[model samples]
Target: MVAKYVMLADTTRCINCKACEVACRAEWDTPLGYSRDWVKEVESVNAKGMPELQIFPGRCQHCDDAPCVEVCPTGASWKREDGIVLVDHDICSGCELCVPACPYDARWLNPVTNTISKCTFCQPRIDKGLQPACVETCVGNALIFGDANDPNSEVSILLKTKEWQRLITDEVNIGPNHYYYTAGKTIPVEVMPKLHERHLAGKSIESIVNPLGTIGIGGMMAVFLGAGVKKLVDRRKEVSEKEDNHEHH
Candidate 1:
């Protein structure tokens, strides 16, 4: 049977030490301004009118029907048989089309590679029979990663024994694989996925390039295609020169 991987974050157990964040950065060489995973602290008043704080460790939800995959013109985004969503960096045009498509705000354009980047469930480590960096380094053991298809897997067992809720909204239901164990408590509004707004660049693409593509306007499409190609070339050259300079230092 094909393995179906899933991740569980027990909100009751997280300590907000940021160990997972640190480990992910070290593992992926993520740029200083960005991260693959994060811990969100939600402060709310409970039913008893007492202050309560819920800590949620979050990342790409790795949805079953990922909108990012559906909207990519270059097919750079894809999902593996094991359910890990990833970007094919070599093919990515850095068009940033998939960024707003994700409701969870998971995808980002990497400054170094000029490609879309997101959490991959630590595929390289998993391929070598190791846990994800974040899961392995979690200080409170709140993060769990394993094959949900395997009944004996820890995640599967947890799902069977524990009450969990996924972060979902009425407007966006993508069947996210990330689960949160909240012990039957109502999930806080702060922890839910918010509606994304298209940036100026995204709006421009939608209004101009998308319409041209749809109507098969060959000349205009070619012009837009050339611009995309030029951007990719410029980025690659920039990265190459930086690498050469680093080697000489």
Candidate 2:
């Protein structure tokens, strides 16, 4: 039996204390600039004349078909067999390609390792048959972690019973494991970090210019091949003309 882990977020129950964020950073010793996990505050406007704010904690989705893994040049980003997304710090080239490839704004570069880092789903505790530190420490019990692959698992059962929405775009279709449930107004896209913009538009000058090179080389090859065939045909025509001249002479 393969072991699997899933993260279930009940935004309705979330108090936005940032306990998960603190616990994750403490356990992993994550640097200042990089965060292995964090909470997002999803606020609603006072349009309904209600004086209140709704909070939503956000973290790595650990999508099944992760774009980070697909775009990583060094193969540093990889999804675990159990479904958690992680980075191989040793193999990471600190290229920042994976950083912007993620739609959830999960990936970040750790100053210490200078490699892409994101949530691991707390693999170490799961190995010891324990829930993730964040899950265990969650005061409101808003965060739930279990094997989503199993229908009987807590997360799977909650997902079926609760109203949930995955924060993602239609094109990527990563099959996000993280589920955020809320009855309040949905968060605006402007508030969320735009992680895919760089990757979609080609982040660096190198990433953009290299593809043009491939197109240029292919075009040049086609032109050269066409010119070679034309020269061959002209030579054949010249030989025939000379032979006819000799015959007529």
Candidate 3:
């Protein structure tokens, strides 16, 4: 059986140094303004009105039922058997259709490649028997990565002994593999998953065009036709609303 790769983030140890973000950017050459990973710090008051802080190191959840993979017009966004979800640049259409499908907002269009880019757990380095850049450079040692299936692995040990949580929501449970050990602190608002926060661009099209029926040129034509009709309807509604306002005047 293939190893189940997972990450255990010890939020108690995170110092908000952002070394992980810098490491990922350096390793991937991620463009300015967009990166494959991030560190979020949320400050709030407890019930006693005392100030408290929580920090989260975040990336793609690499979900088992990834909405990005399900809504991909092409089979470009796919998951390997080992559970890493990746984008095949050559097969992607640059349609930005998968942009809105991720609840975690993990996927983005790479300006350089005109293809989707995201965190892959540094799969290349992992294949080379090295830790992910973020994990390697973590100054606080908050980030831990390894195959969760291996009993001796750090991730597996953490899972067995420590209480952990994911950024999962009750409404949108997708079987995310990332685990968080917060040491009983309230989860930061910045790190919790919000399904309504997902972009609507790709999701709107997916709602209208059935993926199973989209088989070839005929399906492509349906997308165009559906979009045209929607635009026309919106235009007519705008005109009618204008006419009603004019009459009221």
| Ten residues in sequence with the least summed lDDT for candidate 1 | 195-204
lDDT tens per residue, model 2, 156-213: 8988887777766655556888777776457555434354645553455447667788
Per-candidate TM-scores read 0.80, 0.76, 0.80
- lDDT per residue for candidate 1 within 1-249, as digits (tens), equals 998889999988999999999999999999999999998898888889999888999999999998888777788999999899999998999988889888888999999999998999999999999999999999889999999999999999999999889999897788899999988888888778877556576666778879877788777788999999999999999999999999999
Best by lDDT: 1
- Give lDDT: candidate 2, residue 61: 83
**lDDT of all predictions:** 0.90, 0.78, 0.85
Q: Which portions of model 3 show Cα errors greater than 4 Å?
A: 196-249
Ranked candidates, highest lDDT first: 1, 3, 2
**Residue 72 of model 1: what lDDT?**
78
Indicate the worst ten consecutive residues by lDDT in candidate 3: 196-205
Clashing pairs in 2: 40-58
Give a tens-digit lDDT track for model 3, residues 89-207.
89997777777767777888999888988999999999898998999999999999999878998888889998999887788789898999988876865677767333475555555
